[model samples]
Target: MHLRKVYTIARHEYTVTVRRPGFIVLTATVPVLGLVVAVLVLVAGRGLLAQVDTLVGAMEKPIGVVDKSGYFSPVLPAFADDFQRYEDETEVYRAVDEGRLQAAIVIPPDYVQTGRVYVYSPQNVFQRVSLEDSHRLRAFLAVHLSRPWVPEEVLVRLSEPLVTLTPVASRQETAGPWASFTQVLVPYMVAILLVISVFASSGYLIQGLAEEKENRLVEIIISSVTPMEWFVGKVVGLGAAGLTQMGIWMLTSLALSGGAMLALVAVSPIPWYRWGLFLLYYALGYALYAVLQAGLGALGTSTRETQQIAGLASVVAFVPFMLSGLVFTVPDAPLVRGLSYFPLTAPTMMIFRLAVFSVPTVDVVVSLTLLVVSIPVAGWIGAKLFRLGILFYGKRPSLAEIWYALRSA
Candidate 1:
């Protein structure tokens, strides 16, 4: 293998990518939009969160009172400072209907004397407060009142468990609700981006290789360089061009956020490390596909057939991409975990699963090692095919032709 010729092939591939307006745009577009969206999301999310906190605090304020059994009439004020006093439920209803009060309570006319209690809200007349809300109010009233009102033990009983939320373990804790939503979404978008990228890079490597063959330039390169050098060069060269496009995007995002938002996001220790995980998968996936794509490219006479073949693999590789949202609800399911190790589906599926579920560290290590091992093994097969396919172009060689090419190589 001639190192110089390999570098030459690598350089040639790089130049071709740099000169393509389409490739340049595809690589840069998403990161730019992500940065813009990131800023908007941060600002809007903060406003929404801040607004939610304030509203939750306000919603807790007493808008009306309930006096079941007439026992609460004298002690109600101790529990409800802002709750409007009323002679009857009708007055409370009038206050609610006229917008004078946000909510009301009914004492069942025997609440003070009996165990029965009833409350009212315009929002949901029959709806009971959630356990958390009920517990908090009970705790608050229990502390403020002089008389025994809304018995703490009774309130605790009234408030059922609000949610039976069980968490799925992942190495990274989801950055709260909004942050988790953001983390899951980022990968889906990136999957599409990388899918496009795998094709653009590998597809070009093929087109360039095919061009050299058709022009008899490949024969000349083969004279000075081993097929391996030519193949490796083209892959590295084109891959770099792709990375350059990604680099520009990285820079653009840092600039847009003035680095602070990125810093804030990164400090969260969740989504911040996704880029590292994403890159690890990207390299593995790219390596595996690059050889197959190159082999196919060498066999095709026209660019159209080459693209179609490459596109099919991309579509197949992207199949796991659709499962991203589903994993959020069932990340630890056997089906989802199985897909993470399946080569075609692994990159996108496994990464999202890793992000959502607390995948065993052993599992991640094993899966990654498996994918890494597959890369060169895949390349070897593709190289044999590429060696034979380069000279056998036109009308897409039949399965027989591909078979013969492999044997001869």
Candidate 2:
């Protein structure tokens, strides 16, 4: 394997791919869509808030009151403007009908025994009471009734009590049931991004291989550089392209958020050291899948056929994502551990585990070791398949023939 030849192939592949219209469009699509959605949300949110404010302002109009219950006969100075005093229900009804009051309320003289209050408002075809008006009336009653006996500070507390919420874990080191939504969400996002990049890059590799084989370019490519070198070069070039896509996406997100997301990451539960492990797993995972994708591309008779086979592999990679609920609930379960050690699922599964819990050092080391060890083994199998299958045409080889080729290799 010549370094110069491999470098030349890699450079050619990279340049050709980046220049392709599909690559350019696909790379830009995510950022463009994200920006569009964000803008729409901001605009819609502002419009909605404005509408709410307008409705609230309308509701704030003076509500005529006929408080015969005697508890709130003399409206407090603080609420006098909000609750305008009236002589009886007849005057309140006239005020509401004339649009002078948005709503009115009358308390019965038997209020202490029956606790009944009459709410009066103009009824339309579909009448709905204003929530703001009801809340205002309730607050007015609570304060005036308690004012004679309760302290000012106590009245305030009775009107609006302060409640603090705290999440407590059974143990100091464990947060399994007590994990925050952000903690689980951040890791899941990372896993999805990595999985998408890996498969997208691998897809490019397979498409290129299939097209080259269709054009009989592989014959000439192999003659100039060994199949293994060609495979390595394509994987490197395509993987770099995938990284470029991811970088653009991340930079776009950071730019749109004004680096707020970076600040969020800084305070996230994931440790700094785990980021290095993340990169290692991503690279190894890409290499392992690239090997499988390359072999599938070389082995199939058509691009469509090759893609269909690769799609099955793509499903396998998403197994960890599908089991995410289980991961968060039972990170140390046998099934979760089994997936973490499995080569195809390990990268994403370990990534998920890292975010939700403090994964054991032994588990991390073992999972990483398995991923590290799988690439070469996959590559060797891929090489044998590529060597024999690339030259064959007309019909796909049978399992028996494939076994012989592996044996020969």
Candidate 3:
């Protein structure tokens, strides 16, 4: 209960945790790995585009054509080395089968009247053909088919339409595809970050508690300070350490990709206020989980058992993330809305809804209120467990004993 005691404990916990090699590795490695992955993806994407260009260029090999329409044969010479005119469809088919041609284009008798042109390849390879090839073919046809009767402007317009239609919206609505995409993506990222921070920090609290209890260190520590002071100090101290880890990762990410994050914010349609709310919800969510983990850690006598309990809690915490796809698609759905009010799932779901849609103010208010209210209640229960079970060694206290402890003064 004393502020001085709490600060001392918190400082001790934070220092010990931050100095650990695991903490340093995790904090530093996540950002580096993220940067590496992003760079690889960028390089791979460029490589893929280059490969496609090469493939399209390679596709300029000779193509056999059966011009049943009689209109294409005269103009086929204009295509030069790219196309070879064949009198018989059988000859074209034979040429394709002999691997002398990459593909054959068949112009039906009704080609001038009907715009249908059939392209045949030996192995249905064109089914997986790229858009560049299709565009090239269209350009070739458009040039050859243009006549004195049809204006060049008309031909060009027909080949490539310049008209683009975009929906008009007020300043409040997300205006473009990029904005809408970021609206969904940012919330999902924040949700994942929240889960990671909670798990990382709370797991530390659990392990520390289990280890201290195992070593009989809590008995001596408790002798100097009340159990309540020790419990609060450990939670506050460990929570700060967890926050420090999160801060490092965030700073590293920003340092590595500040431009990308800035670009996202520039294009995003969601207001900045929503992000502020996200931070508040994240804190509440962390406190709730941290306290619950602390209580569960108190119940266990070993690191392994505490971890199992923490794992179960983690699974429960991740339910919202599992359902995030559904949340993205239908943020206002009855089931999603219901889960948004649930203390375990609320943090992620609320953020998701706020990002994707114009969530009702009442909904946000109610969810926030519930999460905030649950934190202290969870802390009280966890504190009772910590007080009762901190001294118990080897065997874990039963549910009945935990309940009895809570019921006791």
Clash totals, every prediction: 12, 0, 0
Candidate 1's residue-wise lDDT over 289-338, tens digit each? Answer: 77667766666676676677666666767777677666778887787777
The local lDDT score (0 to 100) that residue 84 gets in candidate 3 is: 82
Candidates in descending TM-score order? 2, 3, 1
- Which residues of candidate 3, in runs, are more than 4 Å off? 32-128, 131-174
Clashes by residue pair, model 3 = none
Query: Which TM-score value belongs to model 1?
Result: 0.65
lDDT per residue (tens digit) for residues 1-409 in model 3: 7889888987898788888888888888979898897798798889888977755644656777787876665553336567788888888888877877777888898987888777777644653264226665676577556644677566556555546555566664437768767877888788899999988887788767786888789878988888888888888888888988898888777778857876786788878898888888888888888888887778777888888876677677788888888887887888898898988888888888888788999889899988989888888888898888787888888879888998995
Among the numbered candidates, top lDDT falls to 3
Best-to-worst ranking by lDDT: 3, 2, 1
Candidates' TM-scores?
A: 0.65, 0.77, 0.76
The models' CA-based lDDT, in order, is: 0.66, 0.78, 0.79
Residue-level error in angstroms, candidate 2, position 124: 11
Q: Compute the lDDT of residue 402 as modeled in candidate 2.
A: 89
By TM-score, who's the top model here?
2
What lDDT tens digits, residue by residue, belong to model 2 across residues 1-409? 7888778888888887777788899889978988898889798889888977855655667888898878887776667678898998888899988878867878888976886777787744222344334556678777877788988777656654655444554432443333466577777778888788767876677777687878878777777888888877777777677677778888998988888878667656566788777777777887788777777667788888878766677678899988988998989999999999999999899888887688999999999898888888888888888877788764577899889999987
